[model samples]
Target: MRFIFLFTLISVSFLGFYNCKKQNDLIEQKIVDSLFYTQAEKSIIFSADSTTPFTCLSALDSQQLQILKKTSRNVKTNNDTTNYLVHRMYRTLFQNQGLTNLAAPEIGINRNIIIVQRLDKTGSPYELMINPKITQHSTSTTVYAETCITLPGAYPANVDRYNLIFVEYYDLQGVLHSEMIENQTAATVQHAMTHLGGGVLPLTIDPLAFTGQEIDSIMSDADSIPMRIFLTTIHSDSLILRKQSIDVRPDSNDLVLMTLIKRMRAALATTTGVGIAAPQVGINRNIIWVKRLDKTGKPFEVYLNPKIVMTSSNTILFNGDGCLSVPGVNGRTQRWAAVGIEYDLLDGTHHTEVVQGTSSTNFTAVIFQHEIDHLNGILFIDRIAKLLQTK
Candidate 1:
């Protein structure tokens, strides 16, 4: 009788311990699931493929849902779906007028969870990774999660942006998790994408600002400028070469803008020039292509609506200030040794950069001054003439 009682007690204890463990695991899983789903609902909703429509989670308010609906209609009208989606995504996600700019969505997982995924222009999915460390203290659980996008590219093409999300949840035990996903094929394709000149050039033009005839004229003029040719004073294109170019407004025709950029870059490549401006090709818009000697590899970059906002008191007389517009004239022009410029990229981001260096080492400052002068209807020879007059 004593042996039977002892065996029964042992069996009861083992069963109780096993049941307790299973219950605890169920509670922990409930906490994790609640946190992950709730956080994902609060985050930006992304479509896995182009055919999938953009959606909003229940966490979004009615106003946000309405905004998303309106944006969706606008996106549908655009022919270039990928580019339009990218533009609209940035605007809606970061700069929506009516929407509050919330922090990036946080996710807590004992293992790994897919927070969000996006399809690139080429229809390849971008993978996201989140690393979270969860700690439990008595009744509450705290989670620290960091998110990163594994860019589809090789070394150096890979870019890391951190601290995008943070997660917290309660009633869960301590758990640590980390995961990494890499795609070399995607990365290589993405790396190639960076070389494709510009980003998100809007196609629609403001009809109110451009009459039908004027639009046709501008388009024709832009198309007439061949990729291999530079409009020069030697070719009787003096009116355009000497005119002060207008600002490239948000309402500017994107087709004209893109055509001018492509043709100007092509024309600059034919010469030994380090920079070329839109007026040099007879279009007369505030645009320039400059070789950034300051950057690694000396990549040629396009700047829209470039303006020199500040100049150093010190000046350097560049010995050979030549131009593609004024071909036969090369003169010593006084240029600022360092200059601060306010310019816009093709992606609509404004940047104020201060470039400084001598004629030999970093010639970027001189390049800025020269190209901006073209936009202002001034040439290197004109600058030399002014210097002579002052002397």
Candidate 2:
């Protein structure tokens, strides 16, 4: 993942037009005159570009004067999902011209795009079009200190923007309109897009690719652990992953799963342990190790072949999640706070349940989803974007 330098290209004709701006007209240069660049602020990725209108926003949206409000637009339960959203936003956004090359990214995320400089029919340096989300909004906008990953190790430029921007966007169906947002949400949306070229706003270029950081390492007691019932217990080393689903089941995979249920019953002697998966014992399987968190503190009731069916549109992102497989680490993730799931128990019994709330912390969703990836042979590390991420 490379830091995409979107505005790097300039047509020979534009060089005539790209004369130096007057001192007072520059965003970063203006900040420097204030003598406000602190040591910390000077060592980050931060900058801004000019604005290019996509839809000709209504210059007369009366909502601009109101105070900023908050919403759940960009909050995701895990880095994987966050990365997914950012990546798609790029591919969907197109320009009228200026694309010299369009190679797809391997560790792809479309949120931040690198626009190539190309000549239009008139032989002038014009940007391909850019579509940016309204990440922040309020009736009144202000720009503040901003950073970027592309221009690494630079000073943050103090800037101002609309307290809230009523951004116009489309749904899966393509109908378009605007939305208002406040505070950090608004700022983040604007900052990520400025890196594309034109529509100059204060955004920091992140040469760094992935967005996740290593909050901490998960700890484990030992390497090889116990095997569950319904499935045969294999070592993590023994598992062969192909993609994101389960590739192999044990000789008596169903029995191995049942054994997990029995263990849940035993572990439930005092409280619910619900279900168990092979990976909990150091083996990786697409299977789950979950049991409903009993209302009255019942033992964990085990289930097999669990699948989420119906779910509400409302999702939440929170922190402090842990996982049994990737031990010693916990962080935030985006998950459907409430989800409906239908699955089968070990005894060939089918169960329908709705996880109306989060499994645990944001990290819990990461872990559960991580385990699901195991079913298809996926890992958390593989999905991480190189930008703004930790080890």
Candidate 3:
């Protein structure tokens, strides 16, 4: 009787622990569902042929990494899904399964890292170890505008911004009231998302702003006066509109390209930029220079003659549109808001054109207009619908 009673107590304790864990998971899921900006779904790692999502960060701990590595070893003898770590695996991957076969493949990638598994769902792999860091404050408040949320929902993509800025971004879809934050608001939002996405916090700026209520004093700076350092003109072999060139004479074309590259890097540097045009330098040439996204931000691609095949009715006005060729001057110009440009990516061997799209918001549009205008001997000032009319 005593033995039976002891066994009964042990079983009950085990069941209780499991049941409590299951309940906690459910509650956490519900909170994430209700709160995160994007919907929750299972994610897989980079290169395995499986579709099971690594539902949460806790599921992707270091033990999982060890399991995946072992499984990778197991699959080396027979299957295609067995080995390798690739880009897609770096995030929790999501896809459909069961289409391939009854027996599952043995290896896979999880969390942008590698993995090994006996079966997709079974076995414990070690997680890549992670720890939180506390950084010293550079600014009393780091400014940012929230563009995405992990708590599945909609949010704004673009907002007025400047680094070391105080600004606000909206998410009316969640948190019934628009979240108001500053300093480390971006930090908090990103931190919360780590659990939602099964990843470590990618350091970033704060996405919230302080109104008069939140901040007693906020600074506003004046725009720099415009200057024309590069005496450039938009001259065209106008009719064909095939190509325009900017005679980069004052500085070596190489130096010219280098300087522009530096300015772009210091201001807005993203891999999204493909090339900068000659008209951008104030000479209308069918000339274009491009640099591919690399470990470094340099324009590596160049096009001597380029063409545009399609256009958009959307018109945009970039508030900070200024010219590298023209110094210190920026004003509003009206141009086709977006264009699907066709040009060669600088292989020098292949001549192909695609509908490269542009919008009014970015310096990209300004750059394109600057280059193409040089093709026609035009400058941003000539297209200027509004120059800062002096008082």
Candidate 4:
């Protein structure tokens, strides 16, 4: 993503018109001095246009965008702290505009905003709308610009599109700096309008976390029965079992996440399974509890947003690869002998782990691949089918 920097300096002017008998009231006017930073050009323009209102003025970078998309708003982290501050700034701006009860809109830099420049009637070049409505309240100076573009959607209605941009400012020493935060869209604003159940706060947090009723049902079930498991035998459960899971953000609901981890561990303990995924528990979230046989204590650990980034060329064929969800089924499946995994912990820390070896010496790598496959909506039986097809 590209960055579009705009440093605006506002000067208020009052002009009085004299009539024949009396002096007319003074009219307040605002003049905006805008400076844009780009790789190609850098220029300053003085604008008197007060008709247009800026749609959004702040944005998040690509990394912050990913964090915003993946992580929920329920959990607190260092990144979340930064995002919260930005959100507060937007909230204040919206409130000042009489747009109360609105969620903070996500913003990001658009590629077009970097290259395209629009000229007004006076031939003054302006990349974004210069609205007098936008007023800066913070002591820290802000430098950012945004443009809204409307695109045709698949349906009859047109989709409003806004390219996201990150906001940064210059300090007293003239050093450019930014705080990491995430962004939202206009669609998100509309959604928030309809769903005001969360009040003024943005409902960016994931709602797919396990409900109390669902949790009670799973916990109360017989130890031998996998009540929470979404089985291939069941038609409704199979739908979720076949779908890809979303990443579990570091800021996911702590109570929900801990409950899931506990229930998954309990479910795994019921059987001889080495690992259990959220999909197996009828939740399509990127979470897994795996028994780390390679570790000294051979403990079970939970990995959120786990992904198998790399695999060894050498393959291992397990004669009886099985699954808790696919009970009564065991088939030969080929898996990587070694695999590298990237995952996150509950504390918002990231880790990369490599597990390798034969099934006899270490089955951790195979287990990792199997669980991560579930996150991608792949089943061990599917692997077995591929093996049979090759034969």
Candidate 5:
């Protein structure tokens, strides 16, 4: 009887422990799913495959470097902190599984070092570098932006980085590793180093003036001075109507794109028109704000790098199409009845969707083609000319 009783007690204890562990793991998975979804909604979150969305940061401890915080103070400059910094770098790399690289400062290590997982045509592999300094920078620059793990709430910014940089550094074993980095990698390294130097975006005259609240107010208040800057009219300039626009670079211009998107939406609210473009306000970037007539709210959607990749075989007559660029000049024009478009959303995700046109009076397809033409430097007047010529 004593033996049977002991066995029963042990089994009960083991079952309790097993159940507790299972519950803890389930809770952890929920947290991870929530974070991954949040990041996907707010920023340029990407994965090697669409199926795997969760990151390893959720399994890590609070003190781990993967957690976003002010990382400026953690970087060490000398050889004394090499072993500690390298260990921290590897830990950070492990914690941030999908990340291409990590900086020592990010993980709370006071050492000027970055661990990068690089792949080129030649394949140099994952390596560590210490005390990196930009010895030379190219005269030309590029606009790039990225989301940081630290500032989870903030959108990416249009940051200026050298197109090419000659960097001098030492490896993990204290050997020299000097190289010239160009293009995307150069931009990434420059962005990470900015964190080491204690710089963050909304680099403004008044720090308090640039918070999330202020931005919301600016976006919401249509008559505000900041909003007025984006207000354009037919008489704005020939450049506004004729200049071709370029794609807004995702590398460093995300904040600029966000601000422009907000202002464009606000500007559109004050007008009776259904659409607006970036060049209309003197910015030559390929962006447009348009009302979604098919949607219930009639919400304005921003499109970046928008292009009509496919169109229907049949043509439709747009009898009356006017523009904010040319007032009091409505004309009949020809357009594709159906269009398949690809554009970048605010979160930097690319999407392709088909907008179907009806034989009745649905103008969504017409509006998309119209705004997209503006990006390619085509005006409504040009369409009228083409129609007349074809006739």
Candidate 6:
């Protein structure tokens, strides 16, 4: 996506009235300066008119925060159910916050409903979770670095959590069912559950390692070098790599996302690898840059919130999968020969398409799956080890 610069526009009549107009201008400038912009020289997009309040916020306002913290009442089978109100909250969140999905408590609605939009790029699904609960969380814990759109100023912080969880919820038809969600999805559900309890703290550690001084150093050097220190397999930020990533706030987090796209492109240019994910650079957002080997002329592109819709029944065994994070190790892995994907382009457009692996060489499918796996904290090595355990 092209990065567009937005300058706040002031009205002539308002400017004509007061000696404090200049003072107000300075105040506005200060707010903008404190609020947005990454040290990497990234730019934020704002409205042409200064009179409009910022649509995206680094943190929720008093009203919004209060709503988010409110304990939601459960929906009933009767007409008094808060299902409709929950849906309204869902739409309002996307409209105002540009979030991909939200929990019941976050929208000031009944605790019985949650709306999740495109978590992946293929076809968008309007899935609803009515009266959802984590029936069980796997005893095995994994480290994850988490982030939230509500706390935009806070960086992703390391947290320990169950790698797998059994979630029981009602479908749209009001049928109760259970699904085993693992890896990154497990992390997401755990995070949302925290909100349900009216907890303001993210599922993260206090005094984040990458906060303050370390973050400052990284951003200061972002223009000159890739933030490779934050990528997967880095020993210091090990959990950060394995953690599931969150979606960027299209309205608020646009600048950092834009800068990430640029930096990833530049970093990939320096590497022989075909793709990279947001967590590779330490930003835990659901975005990835991949090389489209199946296409000509268009060498590489970015996918935001890509979803894997379908996988070919037939599978292919590749020689091995390698990663930038894992230095010299390549492990044999079986992957789908073809897959259907839904993802958003840089301009925030949705698309659904199929990617096929070559009969003779399945590198294309391998790369696509590999990069997408990063979003869920899955590395090729992890996949390889899992395969071995099954045998």
lDDT for each residue of candidate 3 in 327-371, tens digit (9 for 90 to 100): 468777666655556553324333543322234332454455555
Against the true structure, what is each candidate's TM-score? 0.44, 0.30, 0.27, 0.49, 0.44, 0.45
In model 4, residue pairs whose N, Cα or C atoms come closer than 3 Å (at least 3 residues apart or on different chains), thus clashing, are 59-107, 59-165, 59-166, 106-183, 106-184, 108-164, 108-165, 109-164, 109-165
Q: Residue 329 deviation, candidate 5, in Å?
A: 1.2
Please give, for residues 43-71, the per-residue lDDT of candidate 4 as tens digits: 10111122222233221344534422331
Instruction: Name the best candidate (by lDDT).
Output: 6
lDDT of 6 by residue, 227-294 (tens): 66354445766687888976643322344456566777777778888888877776666778887777
Candidate 4 displacement at residue 108 in angstroms: 27
Each model's total of backbone clashes: 3, 93, 69, 9, 12, 7
Query: What's the lDDT for candidate 3?
Result: 0.34
For residues 1-391, could you state the per-residue lDDT of candidate 1 as single tens digits?
A: 2222344455557757776766555554444343332333323233343333233222124443232222100011112432323333333333323221111211111122112223222653332222221222122222211111111111111132221222221111222233321233222222212112111111112322323433454466445354533446454577767888877653223565666677777778778889998778666678899999999999999998899999999998888888877768888888899999999887778999998765676789989999999999887888899888989
Candidate 1 regions with alpha-carbon error over 4 angstroms: 1-225, 228-236, 250-253
Give the Cα lDDT of each candidate: 0.51, 0.37, 0.34, 0.51, 0.61, 0.62
Candidate 1, residue 299: how far the Cα is off, in Å: 0.6
lDDT of 5: 0.61
lDDT of 5 by residue, 129-186 (tens): 6667788999999876555544445454446788999987766555567898888778
Q: After TM-score superposition, what is the CA distance of residue 133 in candidate 3 from its true location, in Å? A: 83
Candidate of highest TM-score: 4
* lDDT score, candidate 3, position 258: 36
TM-score of 5: 0.44
Which residue runs does candidate 6 get wrong by more than 4 Å? 1-218, 222-224, 229-233, 250-253, 358-362
Q: Give the alpha carbon lDDT tens digit for every residue of 1-391 in model 2.
A: 0101112222223443766445224543333333232333222112111122122111123331111111111121223333333333333233323223221111122222222223222452222222335444555667565643222334344556565565544332223445554555455445544433233234333222112220011111111223322212234333533233332222233333334333434432432233344444333333565544434442334444555666668756545443334435555645556556665554455677655435452223333444454455544444442112533
Candidates ranked by lDDT, best first?
Answer: 6, 5, 4, 1, 2, 3
* Residue 46 displacement in candidate 1 (angstroms): 56
Tally clashing residue pairs in candidate 5: 12
